[model samples]
Target: MKKARLWSLLEDGRVQCLVCERRCLIRPGAKGACGNYVNVGGELFHLGYGRLSALESRPIELKPLFHYWPNSTALTFSSYDCNFHCPWCQNYHLSFRMPDISQPVFSPEKLVELAVREGDEGLSASFNEPAVNFDFLVDVAEHASKRGLYFMLVTNGYFTEKALDALLRAGIDGWSISIKGCKGMQKPLGNIDFYVPFRNAKTIKERGGYVEIVYLVVTNTNDYEDCYRWIIEKHVTLLGVDTPLHINRYFPAYAWRKPPTPISKLLEIAEEAKKSGLRYVYIGNLHNPRYETTYCPKCGRPVIVRNNYRVVDWKLEKRDNEWKCKYCGYPVPIKGEYIPEKKWLGLM
Candidate 1:
């Protein structure tokens, strides 16, 4: 366990955690709302700092980050628990529990070294909300930046402005932020402000970090047309139309087990997003290859072809510092170097 950051002491012998938007006021010997940080003698202590629950090498595509670095590998890691209490969380096994502090610790330097040793191009904190490990992430990102490797986070975007500023200063390269819908959905998710995610995404983009948004369509929950319109409008207005939007299909998991999201509904929303002038829209968690592939916005030609996370064909050419279509010469908004070869390294 390590000393936590972004926290302040309270007058009534309590401490407030400022890492995420929750602003949990933890009393002595008690845990925060996320169950990862504990108050020890009126001081805040991070129980999950440098302690990992899951670690493995995964494709950036698995992060659902198609535009940033296609077919590249990232050393992804996650700690236990989450600030949000989504009943239908697919990663319930990881998010529903607290960090096992009894287990061995993995230092930030060691994690960056392992990524370099394994020939990964970047590092990602995923599978669960990463805000609980904010201090550790900043350390790892600092080390990664020094070593010429990129660092990213797959988050629910519940972080406070202070935490987001620290991450930006640490050279965070990319983000795959999840948007669960607007204000009415906060009660089931620990009363978190729905606008926090969108706000942080805009801040990151304004600071020049790559970002992509993920909207998981749950059946009978946030699958309404108005909800989709809200997300699409926010994505365009805040981030811009060139930002890639991933509409994912949700399956029943954990407590709320209603039914799986229908494919027709997922497809319908994706189509609507495209008709609304989103340049890059993709469908995830479904086996339809056509939706997984990336197409040239102008020429309607496939620039990056993929079959279930593996890039099979790359038809774009780099010209004058931009990835352009071979047939139409339309510049695609692809960042970083395109890795031609890849190895499907399974979970460790």
Candidate 2:
């Protein structure tokens, strides 16, 4: 029940929600496209503030963030409501449906306390669209950053420039923006424009924040080689060769009943990305053990070997708080405190 933080009033009695690219204009007593922000009597109010739907300590790899923290765990949280209505959404039950907001409210301080108690490396706003619950995320992130805990946003990267800037200012350590597909699909959710990754990646990189791109390759929708190449050329050429890319295998979920993306297609896309001179490309959702590991681009050696979401072995050496492969002295892109001596649970 917080007043929406990032919106403006229009002259025609409509309020514009500057949360995402939608910039939804809502009249009095009407909700935005996200379903979380409402124009209540000429004022904008956020509906999902302090309302959490799920919380857990999960492996960092489960966020599929291999380049950020290879083998650590993060305290993850998700609230109800999302800005985009992606038909293939896997978390529709929670994101699309309104939760019982009166169940219980956890303040930002309490959420930070829980994250610290769990001994997690960071906090991940995932499962649902964190942007829809922007107020809660900013509050929690501010507290977590003050306590030296990292903050991550597993978002669709469709946030408005102002909202995105505010999150970066609040000390967001990492961002994994899902690039759904190239432009011009049947629905709003399926389209991914060249401007999004190209623009957002530059912004994230300039802020000294880690940015990774996740591409969910549906069979006939966005499985084209040209789209993949465009992403590589745009991001890699503009950002850097070391920028991380996660090619996720899309399964039939929610309203999408298509077959799962084939392993061969995933491999081919990875190969295409590699040939485009991108260094770190990964395949997700499939059980190909070798594809899950991170290899040193310099010497072609497995620097961080993974078994699903678990780190089987780490052959990196730390020097001045940065990780580099001892074999060839090549810098590793991962960012986290390395606990080589601590034993950890294997991936489930």
Q: What number of clashing residue pairs does each candidate have, in the order they appear?
A: 0, 0
| lDDT, candidate 1, 1-348, per-residue tens | 788888899999999999998899999999998888999988898998888988999989988898888889999999989998689998999998999878888998999999999999999999989998899999999999999999989999999999999999998979999998765653356366777899999999999899999999988888888777788888888888899999999998999887988999998988888887889999999867798898999989898988768788999999999999988999998878789978685667
Candidate 1: Cα lDDT at 117: 99
TM-score of each: 0.97, 0.94
Best by TM-score: 1
lDDT (CA) per prediction: 0.89, 0.81
lDDT per residue for candidate 2 within 137-220, as digits (tens), equals 888889999999888988888887888898888888788888876645544454335467557768888888888888898877
Off by over 4 Å in 2: 186-194, 341-348
Candidate 2 C-alpha RMSD relative to the actual structure: 2.0
Q: Name the lDDT value of residue 165 in candidate 2.
A: 90
